[model samples]
Target chain A: MEVTINNIRKEFERFPALNDVSLKIASGELIALLGPSGSGKTTLLRLIAGLDFPTGGQIFFGDEDASHHSVQERNVGFVFQHYALFRHMTVAENIGFGLKVRPSSSRPPKSEIRRRVSDLLDMVQLGGLEKRYPNQLSGGQRQRVALARAMAIEPRILLLDEPFGALDAKVRKELRRWLREFHDRTGHTTVFVTHDQEEALELADRVVVMSQGKIEQVGSADDVYDRPGSPFVFSFIGESSHLPVEVKEKTVFFQGQPIGISEAAAGGGELFFRPEDISLVEAQDALFGKVTACRRLAGTRIAEIDIANDGHAPYHVEVEVPLHAPVALGSEVRFRPTRWKVFENA
Target chain B: MSDKARTSNPAFRDPADEGFATKVALLLLSLAFLIFFLFLPLLSVFVEAFREGWGAYYEALAEPDAAAAIRLTLLVAAIAVPLNLVFGLCASWAIAKFEFKGKAFLITLIDLPFSISPVISGLVYVLLFGSGSLLGPLLKSWGIEILFAVPGIVLATVFVTFPFVARELIPLMQDQGSGDEEAALSLGASGWQTFRFVTLPNIKWGLLYGVLLCNARAMGEFGAVSVVSGRIRGLTNTMPLHVEILYNEYNMVAAFAVASLLALLALVTLALKTLLELRFGAGNAGGRH
Candidate 1:
């Protein structure tokens, strides 16, 4: 089902959790609601799932008004961050819950429910563990069971609230790939909330960047990662280092001297570039910076550089350079950005 | 690790790490306290009950009034316990799952019965039902009796026992949170279905404990029941009131016989509770899963 969230506003007491947030989700599209904690990404997902109602505006499934529909009527499958598997029930029972809960008129027969549960168990790769309780299973197994349970109902839309939020790093990465494969095979119109930008970018077909309860940008992974629409999106979506710069009429200047011409089209703002964009060189016009700190990694070294501004302040930025680079402590270096964005505001 | 620590701490002893003498002294102290305060008093009740031998003890229980008292106590427990159980579940659901203004105030209100003297709890119903109060004349004119009747006794017992199940459930359900219920609802499960399948299973042990406590209090209640029972010989006089009546009339054996029965009921309740605690270890009262 295609979901349209129109001008939704949610208020708790006098504070707004979601303020005029709107987005459209295409059918069979895997989307990510990406934001920091308290940014209302989970709130928007909850509204879409019919777990909560908007204080203002409406939600539509295709052309039908879903504002007044109950969670049962909305026909959504939600996977919680903490798995939320029923502790008393075995894995097979957990997966069959949605089928069993249907009204008798529409509920699947017991044998059919059993077969479907087993089929789901195989899909999630936990086939023979049907009789095991949730507590007896590993966290990853429990989450897979939660997913299987949600899918049993064949819901109109599947909503996941940080599905891998509680897992360890290695397990989280494994589940991310598994979930993408699952989505591909199942073709469910899914929307998941996550604070981890990497997870959102890697798993979602479209990423909706949110900040302070407002949608900042909505685009494909590359679109949000590269051509961020606003400073918030640019700051939030990817790893970018920033330096305070001055932009005057025909040129962009760093430390009161012209540095580049292409960046002058935008007004004075903070210039942001990824660590890979900075290169050390012997140029007189380059921004002079001192290597303040260095960290060794597998094949590269990360250097924290402190670049002094025209004023007394300095901006500290991290750059990943080749391990052979001359980046010893207190070493002075001249550097220039190969690619950067001027956000037009400091 | 033990050898290293012991050598280093040859003179650096933790006072709490005791020798046999200290352990024995603490054990004897606790035993003495239990003997004087708990076991001796319980033993004395059994001894006094059999003072006139089993014939007279059995006769006391066989009396028409005594039989009526036992039946009334059982009936009140049956009525009061289930009513309180339902209230407890509802209260726990509301207080634990949903956030609202004045939730603390509502919780405090639920705890009111725990803090109020039992005499005051019964007095509240009396004030509402007594002849000089509002609605009293209207109820009297309608041929309805509340105070000095079964309804009054049931009401008092319900009031005193109402908090048991909720007290057990709220902390637990709150800790477990509405995560499972939300998961159910999102899976297209109805509200009733979600509660029955997810929320209820998670809180089953806590609910069982609450019901046990409510039933025990309902059956053993004396202060609040006495205030409303009005000492009606075969109707309102519950087991505790019967013991008081027999003892005051110098029927020592009869009084002790009834008291002994209540004591046995208390012992059985304690034993069952302890057994359950040993089995379940108060685990997941907060709905861990």
Candidate 2:
């Protein structure tokens, strides 16, 4: 189901949690609401699930305005970080709960419910653990049960809040791949909240980067990674460094000299580029920063350099170089960004 | 320097480890205190009750007024406990699962019965429903008898036992959280269905724990019931009040016999609580689900 969020604003007392946020999630697409803690990503997900109501605005499920609908009315499957499975119920019972609780007229037969539960258990790869209680299963197994339980309802949209947050790193990676495949198989309009940028980038078709209760940027993985729209996005999404420079006549200047970079914007601005996007240059006009430290990361040598800013504070940036390069502490290397974006300072 | 210091410091021990002498002293002190204050008094109740032999004990318990008091006590508990169980579940569910205005004030109000003297608790009810109070005349005009009757005794018992169930459940439910309930709702379960299938089962153990305590308090309540019961023989006197009346009349054997029944109830409560804690870990009270 397609979801349209129209100027949703939520407040707790006088503190605004989501500030007039708006977005449209297409049908059968996987979206990630990615942000740090307290960034309103979870709040926005809750609003979409109808677990919370916005202070002002509307949400439409397809063509229906469901702003005031309860979670039960919304028919959206939700999975929590802690896998909030009913501890007392067996796996089969948990999976069958939503079907069993339906109004009698629409409820499936007892045998049908059992068959469906069995099918769901099989689909989640827990085929014979039907009698196991939630506590009896491993963390990953319990989360799979939670997902199967959620899918039993056949919801129009699926929502997950840090579904893999409580698992160990290995299990989390496994679940991330499994969830992506699961989403493909089910083809449900899925939206998940996450703080891990890599998880968002890897698992989502589109990533919505949020900060301070507002949407910073919404785009595909490459769009967010290579072409961030804002400074926050640039610093938040990947390993990037920024240098404060002035732009005059479309030429970027540092320390009263043009540093061989040009931009459309005029006046002072910050230039942001990835560590691997720069290369060592022998040009005299290139910024030759003193290497303060060097370290090996995943077979690549990364040197932390500090450029003296004439009379102002020096700027620190990390530049990736060849493993055999002579980049050492206290040595100076001249480098220029191969590709960079300049954001005019406000 | 460290090797020499370590060799010389043979008497040194871990700071967390208590000295043998200190441990022995603490154990002895607590054991002595328990024997004097708790075990002795409890032992005395049984000793005094059975002093006149088992025949007299049976005779005392079988007396008309004694039987009446026992029945009344059971009846009051029967009515009060279930009422408090429902109220406690609702109150704790509200307090633990949701945020609202005046919540702290509501919690403090729930604890009011525990803080005030039981006599005051009973008096407050009397003031609300007694013959001379504002509602008393209105209730009388409607021919309802609450004060000095079974209802009054039940009310007093309910008042004193009100906080037990809610106190046991608030922390447990809070620890368990609303995650399960929200998950259920998002899976298309209605509010009632979510509570029935998810919330209720999660809290069942803690609920029973609370009910056990509430039952004990309702059966043994004295100070509050005493003031409101008017001490009417057979009609309003509970087991505890009957024991007091028997003692006041110098019916030592009967008083002790009745007192032993209340003691038995307390022991049963403790046994059941311990059994619950054993079957379901004590952490079940916190419900770490």
Candidate 3:
């Protein structure tokens, strides 16, 4: 269902967790709330789930004002980070909990509940494990069971708080792919919270980047990665080296030396470029530096260069060259920024 | 091995030869004290109870007063344990799951009876239910003799054992937090349903432990029961009061007999506690779920 959060704010005693933030999540769209620890992503998700109330805001679930609604009335499915499954119940019983608790008039029959549970187990790729308790299952299996249990009620929205965070690396990767496929097949409006940017980019159709209890940027995976709106997003979304650049009459200078800016039309701004965007050249008209360290990264040699120009602070720059390139440590190298973006630093 | 080699090898040396005699002596002394001060008295009680064979034991058990006392004690336990279980669950739920003003004071109040002497706890009830108290006239008007009756005995036992269950459950429930309940709530489970399905199952083991402890304390409560029960025969007297009466009447065999029952109950509680720890693991007590 469509969710509209208007001027939502949350506070813990004197500390504000969510600072008047607002966003709209269209129905059937999978979104990821991405942030570092204490960034209010989980708090926002909880507010949307009605597990917590916003200090000041109006939450609308398809024209129904859900600001004062309890979690039970919200009809939202939530998956916890640790997969808080009922240890006392078997997988089948856990999955069938929502159906069992439904009002008698709307409750499914025993056979239908069983069939639905089995169908959910199949959907989550846990077809034959209905008899197993949560403790008896593996971490990934327990997470999948949690997911299946959440989906049993056919909730209007699914909220996952770092669902695959507790799994090992291999299992995390596998679950990420599996979650993408599951979302595609189910087409349920889902919002998951995570601090891992890679998981957000790999899984979410839209990523909501949060910082300091505020939304920094929200966009598609490619939009966020290729065009970060803020410096925090630029640094948080991907790896990049930010070097101080002086703009004089539309000409950018690095380390007190003239740098190539023929393509950069910005008059005066700080230059930001990814390591892969910088090219190591043999000729001049580029910022001069000396190679300090070289490391092989996936068939590419990443050379760390330290600029050595007077009247300029020494800055470390990374350049990606071919694996067979003859780049040696402590050797003089000329580098030029290729694809770069300029931002006004406040 | 040569003597020099044995001396060089610390592992091969006798503890006595290694000059650990003082430590060994201290250890043995403490063990002897423990056996004499603790186990010996326990063993003596058991031996005295069964000394005249099962004949005297059966004779003591056949007494109407003894039967009444045992029944009253069980009745009190039945009333007290379940009441305390409900109270403990509610109190722990409030204290552990919710934050509000005076929370620290409420926690301290819950633990007050544990630190206060049982006699003082009984006195508090007596002060409330005695002839001159506020509710005394109303109770007397209704022909209720709570000060020196079965109700008084139950009240005292309940008072002294009030903290047992809640104390056991608070830390456990607190550590569990609101995560599972929140998950259940978001999944459309109502408050009672969430409690029954998610919250109760998570804390069931802890609740069981608390109930067991509360039951034990309620059954064996003597000081508080004696204060308020008035030590009447076959009327208000409980097991502990009956034991005291038999002992004072110079009926050592019967007195020890009743004491042995209580000791057995304590022993069973200890065993149950150990078995619970072994089966569930000590870490489970933290309520990680």
Model 2 CA deviation exceeding 4 Å by range: A310-312, B1-14, B282-289
* Candidate 2 chain B, poorest ten consecutive residues by summed lDDT: B280-289
Interface RMSD of 2: 3.3
Give the C-alpha miss distance for residue B127 in model 2, angstroms: 3.0
Q: Alpha carbon lDDT of residue B115, candidate 3?
A: 92
C-alpha lDDT of candidate 3 relative to the true structure:
0.87
List candidate 3 stretches off by more than 4 Å: A254-258, A262-269, A282-285, A308-314, B1-35, B131-144, B282-289
Clash pairs (backbone) in predicted model 1:
none
> Candidate 1's error at B76, in angstroms?
1.5
Candidate 3 lDDT over B194-275, as tens digits, reads: 9998888787777778888898899999888888989889989889989999999999899988888899999999898777
Q: lDDT of candidate 1 vs native?
A: 0.87
Residue A56 Cα positional deviation in candidate 3, in Å, after optimal superposition: 1.8
Q: For residue B147, what is the lDDT in candidate 1?
A: 90
Q: For candidate 2, lDDT tens digit of each residue in A61-87?
A: 999999999888999889888988887
Clashing pairs in 3: none
Worst 10 residues of 3 chain A by lDDT: A261-270
Quality of candidate 2's docking, in CAPRI categories? medium
